[model samples]
Target chain A: MNWLMVVLGALAGAPLRYLTDRAVQVRHTTVFPWGTFGVNVTACALLGFLTGATTAATVPPALQHLVGPGLCATLSTYSTYSFETLRLAEAGAKFFAAANALVSVLAGLGAAYLAGALATALLG
Target chain B: MTREHPEDDAPAPGPEPKPTGWAAEPADPDTAIDPWPPKPGRPSRTPAREQAAILSVIALGGALGACARYGATLIWPTDPTAFPWTTFWTNVSGCAAMGVLMVLITERFTVHPLVRPFLGTGVLGGFTTFSTATIDTQRLLDGGRLATALLYVSATLAAALAAVWAAAALTRRAVV
Candidate 1:
C-alpha cells in the first residue's frame, strides 16, 4: 500500500514539477529559481500539515504514508536546489545565489512551522 | 570515430543531449539554448516521437525513485518523537549521488537522452526532498525539541551542500 501510494504521488509530482518550473520561469530570466523555491515551500506546507494531522491523531498511520513521504518527498527536491545554487555561484551571481539559498531555507522552514502550528491549533 | 579535425563539417555532429544541469526540462517553455539558430537546437534531437517518450521516462523513473524512498522509510521507520534519520540520510545520499551523476553525464560520458530524464530529473528529483526535511524540523520544534530541530535543520543544509560540492570536486579532479 505504501509503495503504491509513493508511485501514485510521484506520478503526479514529477510532471507538476516540470510544469510549475516552466510556468514560473517563462516571464523571468533571473538567476533566482523562483519556480523551485515556490514548489519546495508549497510541498513543505503540505507535508507539515500531514505531520500535524498525524500528531493530532486525526490521520491514521496508513493514510499518512500516502501524503507525507509519498506526495511531499516526491513533490520537493534537494538535488536541484543544490545544483542551481552552485550554478548561480559559478555564474558570478553570488548575491542572488546566497539569497536564493537563504530564502529557500527560511521560507521552507517557516512555511512548515506555520502549517504545523495551524493544524495543531485547529485539530489538537 | 576518426581522431581528425573535422570541426567545420556541419556543426560537429551534436552529441546526444544529456541532462546538463538541474531542472533541464525538455518540455520547458523558456528554452533559450539557441536563440539565433531560429528553430533552436533541440527539435531535431527530440524529433516528434522522442518527446512523448521523454515524458514517460520521467514518470516511470519517478515511480521507481519514490518507491525506493518508501522502502527506506519502511526499513527505518521513525515515530513522531524520534529523529527522522531515514529521510535525512536519504537526502544526503541522493544529493551526493546527484553530484557524481551530473559530472559523469556532462563531463566524463556521453549518455542517452533518456538517461538524463530517467535519472537526473525523475529519479534524483524524486529521491531527495527539501519539503520533508523542513516539515520534519517543524515536527521536532513543535514537540519542544528545539535543540534537535536546530541541529537537524542546520546539519541537513550544511551536509547536503557539502556533499554535492565535495563529490563534484572529487569527481572533477579524479576524472581530469
Candidate 2:
C-alpha cells in the first residue's frame, strides 16, 4: 500500500512538475524557475495541513495517506529548485539566485504554517 | 614567463603536398593518423527491454528514498509549535547526497544509463522533499516562530543550492 502511494504520488508530481516548469518558462522568459518555487510553496502548505489533519481527532489515516503521500509528494519538488538556483549562480546572477532561495524557503514555511492552522481550526 | 614555439623557430621547408583519400592515392605513413575516430551511431529507437529496466530501478530506488524520508520524520520528534528539525535535516542531507552522488556517478563510476533514473531521479527525488519544507515553514509562522521559520527556509534554500554548486565544482576540478 505504501509502495502504491509512492508510485501514485510520483505520477502526479512528475507531470505537474513538467507543466509548472513549462508555464514558468513561458511566462518568465528568464533563467529563473518560478514554477518550481510556486509548486514547492503550495506543496509545503498542503503538507502542513495534512500533518495537522492527521493529528486531529476527527481525521483518519486513509485521508492522510491519500493527500499527504499522494498529493503533497507530487506537488513539491526539491530537485528542480536546486537545479535552478545553481543555474542562476553559474550565470553570475548572484542576487537573483539569492533572492529566489530566500523567498522560496521563507514563503514555503509560512504557507505550510497557515495551511496547518487553517486545517486544524476547521477540522478540530 | 614568455614561451616560444619550437616549430616556429625552425626553418621553413618546401610547400607541403595536399593529402588524398585511400582510393585517390596509396596510403602514406605521414597521413596515417586519424584524429577523429568514427563513432557508432545511436539506433532510431530505444529497446523496450532497456526502458523496462530503467523503470524498475527508478521504482525500487524511489521506494527506498521515500521510506528513508519517512524514517527521518519519525526519528526527530518535535511539537507543532516548535521548529521541525526532521524536515530540515532531511532536505539538507538529501541535497548533500545528491551533490556527492553527481560527482561519483559522472566521474568515478561507469554507471549504467538506467542507473540515473533509479538513483538520481527516483531515490534522491524521493529522499528530498519540497512539500515538507514548505509546510514546515508555514507551521513555524502559524506557531508564532515567524523569524525562525523565515530563517530556516532561507538557509535551507541557500545551503542546498550551494551544496550542488560546490559538489559540481569540486567534481570538475577533480576530473581535470
Candidate 3:
C-alpha cells in the first residue's frame, strides 16, 4: 500500500516536471535553466510544509510517503540541475552556470525555511 | 544545453526576429542535456500515441527509481540528529550514474529517443532530489545543529558536483 501510493504520486510528479520544464523553457530567452529552478524551489517549499506538518502530527505517515518521497522528490531533480550547470559552464556561460548553482541552493533553502516556518506557525 | 528558440517549432503568425545570445545547435534530440524545445527544427507536437508512450515509460521509470530510493532509506535509516547519509549517498551516486549514462547515450552509442527520457529524465531525475537535501539542511538548522547543518549542505554540494565531473571525465577517457 505504501509503495503503491509512492508509485501513483510519482506517476503524477515526474511527468509534471517534464511538462513544466517544457512550458517554462519555451517562455524564457536566457540560457539559464529557469524551468528547473522553478520546479526545484517549488518542490522545496512543498516538502518543507509537509515535513513541518508531519512533525506536528497533522500529516499521516502514508501521506508523507506519497508527497515527500514520491511527489516532491521526483519533482525536484539534482541530476538535471548539475547537468545543466555543467553544460552552462562548458558552453562559456560561466557566470550563469555559477549563478544557477549558487542561486538555486540559496533559493531552495530559503523557500524551505520560509514554508517550514509557516507550517509550524499554522499547525504547531 | 543549447538555448532552444520556441519559434523553431511552433508556427509563427508574423516574421519575428529570432532572439540572440545562445546559438541553437542542431544537437541530436537523444543527446540533449535538457529535453526542452525539442531540437531545432522538429515539430513540437508529436503524434498523440507517441506522446502517450513517452509519458508512460517516464512514469514507469520514475516509479522504479523512487522505489529504489525508498528501499535505500529503509535499509539504512538515519537518526534525525545524525547526518543523512542515505540521501547524501543517493544523490551523489545518482549524479555519478547520470554522468556515465549521459556520456554513453550521447557520445558512445546511438539509442532510441525514449531511452534518454526513461533513464535520464525519469530514473536519475527521480532518484536524486534537491528539495529533500535543502529541507534536510533546514531541519538540522531548526534543531540548532548549526555546524552539522553547514557541513551537510556544503559537503553534499561539493561531493555531488565532484562525483558528476569525475564520473563523466573518467567515462569519457574509458570510452572515447
Candidate 4:
C-alpha cells in the first residue's frame, strides 16, 4: 500500500476535523454535540463508499488506505463522543445523552448504507 | 511559546493561586479544579506562534496514528460481511489509552498544555474512530447478518466505554 496516501489523507483529515468542528459549534448554539455528530456521519458515508468501491475492485485498494482508514478515521472521533457522553451524564442531561447516542448510531448507519449503495451503483 | 497575551500572565481572572514552584498541592488536592477544561474558543495565553506549533504537532501525530490504524486493517483484511475485529480493537484500545492519558495530563501531571492537545487530540483521537464502526455494522446488517451486526455494535460500544472507564479509574487510583 502507498503509505504516503495515509499521511496525505491525514494531513487533510485532521485539519478538516478541527475546522469543521469549530464551524459546526459556531453555527449551532446548543448543548447537543452537533459538531462531532456531523463529522461522524460525513466520515462514515465516505468510508462506506470507499469500502464498497475497493471491495468491488472498482478502485485500487491503495486508495482505501487514504480515504477509508486514513481520512475517515481521523475525521471521526470516539474520544469526543465518550467525553461528551460523560459530560452530559454528569450534567444530568440524561435524555440528551441517550438521544445523542441513539441518533448518532442511527444516522451514521443510514448514511453509510446509502453511500455504500450509491458507490456500488456508480463505481461497481 | 509566545507570551503575547500579557493579560493572561498578569494574574488569571479566576482565583487560582499562581504556579508556586510549578506544583499545586492544595490542602485537599482531591478534585480537579472547578471551571476545569478551559472554555473552547477562548484564546489561550500562548501566542499565535505557539498555537501554530501545537497544531503542527497534532497534525504530525495524526499522520502516525492513521498509519498505525491502516496497518492494523491491512494485517487482517476482513470481508465486508464479517465483523471487523481490527477496527473494534483499535477503537477500544485507543479509547482506553485516551482515558489514562487525559487524566495523567490534566490531573496528575503538570506538563505543557499543548501536550494534551498533541497526544490526546492528535494520536489517540486519530487512532480511534466511531464512524467506521457504524459503517461496518450497517454493511453487516445490509448483508443480512443482523445478529452479527447487533453483536458487533453493542460489543464494541460496551467494550470501548468500559475500557475508558476502567483505565481512567485505574490511573486515578494509582496516582491520587
Best by DockQ: 3
Comparing 1 and 2 on lDDT, the stronger one: 1
| Candidate 3 structure quality by residue, lDDT tens digits, B1-176 | 46668867778677777532122421112224344455565435567887787778878888888888888888999887888999999999998998888778767787897998899878888888899889888878878989998899888877887887889889989995
Superposing every Cα of model 3 onto the true structure, what RMSD results?
Answer: 6.9
Per-model TM-score, in order, reads 0.80, 0.65, 0.85, 0.80
For the predicted complex of model 2, DockQ is: 0.22
What TM-score does candidate 4 get on C-alpha atoms? Answer: 0.80
Which of the two candidates, 2 or 4, achieves a greater lDDT against the reference? 4
Using DockQ as the measure, what is the rank order of every candidate, best first? 3, 1, 4, 2
Instruction: Indicate which candidate wins on lDDT.
Output: 3
- Which 10 residues in a row give candidate 3 chain B its minimum summed lDDT? B20-29
Candidate 3 Cα outliers beyond 4 Å, as residue runs: B1-43
Candidates sorted on TM-score, descending: 3, 1, 4, 2
In model 3, residue pairs whose N, Cα or C atoms come closer than 3 Å (at least 3 residues apart or on different chains), thus clashing, are none
lDDT of 1 by residue, B39-110 (tens): 433332334566577667877877788888888887888886677788889988988887788778767887
> Candidate 1, DockQ to 2 decimals?
0.46
Quote the lDDT for B69 in model 3: 86
- List model 2 lDDT by residue over A27-119, tens digit each: 433445676777777778778777777666566555565567555765565765675666566556687677777777778767766877798
Model 4 segments more than 4 A misplaced: A55-57, A120-124, B1-47
Write candidate 1's Cα lDDT for A73-124 as tens digits. 8878888787777766665668877887788989998888788778888899
Worst 10 residues of 4 chain B by lDDT: B25-34
